[model samples]
Target: MSGVITGERRSADTHSARSGGGAFVPEATPLDDARAQLAVATGLLGYSDGLHAMLATPRRELTVAVPLRADDGSTMLFTGYRVQHNFSRGPAKGGLRYSPGVNLDEVRALAMWMTWKCALLDVPYGGAKGGVAIDPRLHSKAELERVTRRYTSEILPIIGPERDIPAPDVGTDEQTMAWMMDTYSVNTGYTVPGIVTGKPISLGGSQGRASATSRGVTHIALAALKHRGISASRASAAVQGFGKVGRDTARFLHQAGLRVLGISDQYGAIHNAGGLDIERLCAFVDETGTVMGFPGAEPLDRDLLLELDVDLLVPAAVEGVLHEGNATRVTAPVIVEGANGPTSPAAARIFADRGQLVVPDILANAGGVIVSYFEWVQANQAYWWNAAEVEAKLEERMLSAWQQVVDYATQRTLSLRTAATVLAVERVAEAHRLRGLYP
Candidate 1:
């Protein structure tokens, strides 16, 4: 087992997990962009500068140095962060990610987004996010577990069942949450399931937490398609970022009889004029860690895949994939952002001006947080809901939120993304006003 572990740990030596230049800004980070987004959104919503400025920044940020002893007998240090974007409504909730790209700025923006995502869905939780800057891909399960435990301990001071709860995000999942839940529980001397969301079902994870985001994305896509008068069954769909959100969104859409023409991941892309077999593709992804070499599909350049002519495009991976450069080339009539900030404001404007409908992240990807809320509720109540119950509630909420945004967009003649941002920011602002500022 130890030998198997060391072999897997050697894979990180190839540098596939490089986190795109987060060390460049030492102090104020890319998360500043999330604040900038709030600023822009507040401007759009007609909020005063003083109020927008307050919403732009995180309330608390904890930086911890996580030191781990690797199996190779080498000691390594990782930078970990927990940024709570807001805590007005209830306890903070979000995912903890382990990646080479984890940094204060990214975490801050993500946390801020969480604040709004929670508020938009009316979930009784605020927004928070944490991450450690390290490549988990190069480590074995034991090494990963050690890293997770240590990181959890480092952030232990601020996390709790009634405080800030953490779940799995990028490069983390149920096993990760399981470790988190155990670490917190072990120290507290009792099992406290509410301390985390997205845990293993045996430990109180929700029935559909894993696929909640994708399911929600599918619901948003269906809504967007309908609003635009595009029949989902006849629509050609392309999904970028074929991981948790992308793959599941594709799966749901495919199950709904949509022709998924193209899909891509960090490795590469696969294309089919008719429709690719998402089931086989998902199995291939599970076995190989990507969708690059799936049989019966021809490879296409990752950049070019986005330019493909399709009725719908889902950017389910990273942010800023659709910027000024490719936003104009977007041939899709409906752009459903399954990923956070996948389309920049300028690019979103290009699509909007072109009469394209974009379902923003706050609304489109609210499913994960919604399910996380369910998990949290089940944990606190000491009862778990069945998958059917979870899915039915999820669908009901997604549809209601969709209608709210659609009505607002229609009445104001605004873009869906704009309407969503406005709606989310307004709700948070209203909550803030109801509570009033604490002097």
Candidate 2:
């Protein structure tokens, strides 16, 4: 484990080219924070260094070049990545992100986190993540489809319904999954709906799959608020992202009686101390493509939204938004991470010291994967579940996991993140031990 850690540090330094010694000290990345969290869990479990090393490393990874032909006949190239961090428990499962910032390291971290999240939730799957470094917003519908198909085709050999399943994430959506499914199906000469989740409902997507993450986040947020003795009607929240996860999260939180005071997207943020009309705000975004200039709220500095003095803060945006610089200024007594790795190690430690109730992303956002599991099951059986049944099952699993994490945290005096990760690591390690190494 020490050797592995040292090697990672050296790799980080090598990537840096800012120092006189050709070192550009980069900021701590999601992978750095992920390994740190795993270290804590492995230490708590008293695992051997060999096992620790295995848990820290990705099982397989692939990088590909994605070339695109624009409508005007221009040529562009993008890098794409697919990482399967672990498959000890079952098939690898994670999302396919399309963003300008997508990189191998970020995908690795997300895949690793998916491993723990699946294990923690008792989902029969390991962890995997895929991404293409192109901004979906900057491309046309046809261009995005070409990129998705090209990227999917590039990685088709490694992905399948029974191997790795890719869903939507970040800049991608159900339409993206549809493209991936079509590309993979065309190559295989048949439909393989199970190859991906979060597809359009007509194509075997589960009834409640689209809003699973947000619904899951809200469920855990309400539970966290209650655990902290905050009532939904009296509680106020600020959501820091307005994408796939954040938009629905804000709406659901508002629906559940939380005064959603602020909402932000990459362009800007808006605030209404009296609780913004989420429906109207969502409509405004639909019409104008941004949360800024909503008639019902005042414009706010995007960064300041995180520092708002709300009862609960939900950072559903990108990674490292709430770092050391802004963690202390964050006034929300309870934070439910709606995005993966939204809180950094330093920020997590600060929150722990302050006795803040921070719900880790793995637990808070497991709803998507949980429902993804359901969608996969349905696809395999050729029998789909209704929305009510899906939502009920999702809530049952989410709350059960929440109780287990809370109990473990209380018994061991560990933060929720540590407790959840320790439990998950223990489960995955036990599975590995039982399976034994391949000859």
Candidate 3:
């Protein structure tokens, strides 16, 4: 009964939702974009409507009320969601995020993307995602901890090491995971280190896990540049988000000899045509908590950063940053997505028409999940690998997946996104066929 939502019904439900301003925005939402992509891949793979519906619908969805007690003795109620998109290949695995924009549809899209990401990388995980509708920036550390614990407790019925594993995402990190692990452990009356990943090293987290996503993005970006006949030493990049993923991605790109010209955080963007000193900028951000007001670069408009005339543009921020409105203005010859779903369907069409190469998110930013799988394996085995070994394994996996996607894209004359999705969807669909349906 759970997977009964047909494609038509799903489309209707997705389109009916309105934005905060009471406008029936006609543009594609993240869920719409995700379903559209899947439809294309399924069509190419010769899948029937029944199997497409099975792939489109989430296997399970949970919504919970997360009430947190503030330090000021006030109660605030927040909504949280966890959507498990698929489970045919293996256990569900994804990240838990905290943001004001967190919603059921966004989580659903993210969970579906996670499924493809895992499958593309050959990791043993189905796609799942969890998020709370609260901004971590506005809350105190204690408040965030309370929110995480309460959210974890509410979703305890569905999450576990071998069932559904949560890692860090947008507004969440290792400390949040530590709290969730502690909450789950206290409830079960035993320690469950594998319940979550991205924890502190002291808590059995894998080495090199913190920067794994960024590392992976850098690897793919360099490869993409090379494929386009751009040398790393000559290429310039503009990273349009300096948060968890963007900050480290910029650093890695700079270290790899790319001239990182622009970087942006939520506050503002800064640019240096001659290339900014990434290490110095990092130190300044560490001291001031923003990329704005850095002595080494002049302030640039946040939106213009996306349109910069750079060789490589990494939109490592949030979803839909490179949508219809500004897709035409984006002049970057190559784009490597660091954030999930950064380029919408319309934007992708524009890029295709313009002959711009886009390295899709599932293939470009899978380093985190690849290493998360390693961490989970380590926890389950009660043994850990050193940083060198972990990174080597991650690089090997990332490069292998990149090569596979490139070859598939070239062979079929399809874009990388379509090729990656087709590869992942085919794998999941084959697994489902092998397992068959249960009465």
Candidate 4:
């Protein structure tokens, strides 16, 4: 495990050069954070060194060169990766991201998180993540399709409906999944809609799959508020990162009666003490491509969104946003993490010391995977579920998991993150022990 961790760190550092015009963004080491998290859980379970090392290392990983023929009759090369962190529970499942900062360590970290997330939700899937270090925003539709197909083909041996499934992430969306599914199907001489989730609804995708994560966040946020004796109508929130997760999170929070006082995106952030209209703000983003200058709010520094004096704060954009530098200034009593690793270990400790309730990402954002499981079942059974049925099941599963975590935390006097990780690690370790050593 030490050798693997050291290799990943070297790989990340070797490939740390900035791509195109994107500046080098320094952030916390996700791989280290992941290892630290595993250490805590292993300590709690009293696991042996061998077992701890086994859980820390990934089951399998692949790095490939994705060659793309540009529209201008030129060739371009990009590095891509797929890491299957664990598969003791079931098939591996995670997202494929495209960004300038994509690296092996980040994917490894994300894959590890997915393992715990599936166990926490009892979703019957392990963890895997794939990524390509190319900015989709700088590429054309045709270029992205070519890259997706080539990348899928390169790692085709490991991915399938029953093996490892890939879904959308930061820079990938429904179209990207559609391309991967089509490419895999073409090679196999038949359609394989189950190869990926978050595909177009017409292509065997679940009705509520797209917004599942945001909906799950809302469910947990509301539950946290209730546990704190706060009413949703009187509550207020500030959301950071108004992208896929953030935008929908804001809308759902507003719909649930929380006054969304501030919302931020990559361009900038907007605020209104009296609560801005979410519907119009969404429409404005759709038209102008950002929330920078929405008609109903005033502009403020993006970092200020984290310190807003609201009942709830959601960091739905990127990782390491809530680090030691700003964690002490946070005023929100409850934080529902919509993004993976949004709160660093140091910041989490700060929040814990301050008596803030920090909902772990694995528990808060399990809705997407829950519905992905439903979609996979529907695909295998050749039957689909309606939106209402899907949403109801998602809500039920999310709330059940939430209650389990809360109870465990309360009983052991542990933080929610520690409780959730401990529960998940125990489940996975039990499965591994039952399966025994396979030659």
The sequence of per-residue lDDT tens digits that candidate 4 reaches over residues 194-262 is: 899999998989999999999999999999999999999999999988887888899999999999999
lDDT per model, in order? Answer: 0.83, 0.90, 0.91, 0.89
**Model 4 scores what on Cα lDDT?**
0.89
The true-structure Cα RMSD of candidate 4 reads 5.4
Q: In candidate 3, what are the lDDT values of residues 71-176, reduced to their tens digit? A: 8887788888999999998999999988777789989999999999999999999999998877778789998999899999999999999899999998899999
| C-alpha-based local distance difference test score of model 3 | 0.91
Off by over 4 Å in 1: 1-33
Give the number of colliding residue pairs in candidate 3: 0
Q: Residue 72 in candidate 4 has what lDDT?
A: 81
- Taking all chains together, each candidate's TM-score versus the true structure is 0.92, 0.94, 0.94, 0.94
Mark the regions of model 4 whose C-alpha exceeds 4 Å error after superposition: 1-27
Error of 3 at 138 (Å): 1.4
Q: Tell me, what's the RMSD of every candidate? A: 5.0, 6.0, 5.6, 5.4
Clashing pairs in 3: none
Q: Could you tell me the TM-score of candidate 4?
A: 0.94
Cα error, candidate 4, residue 385 (Å)? 0.4
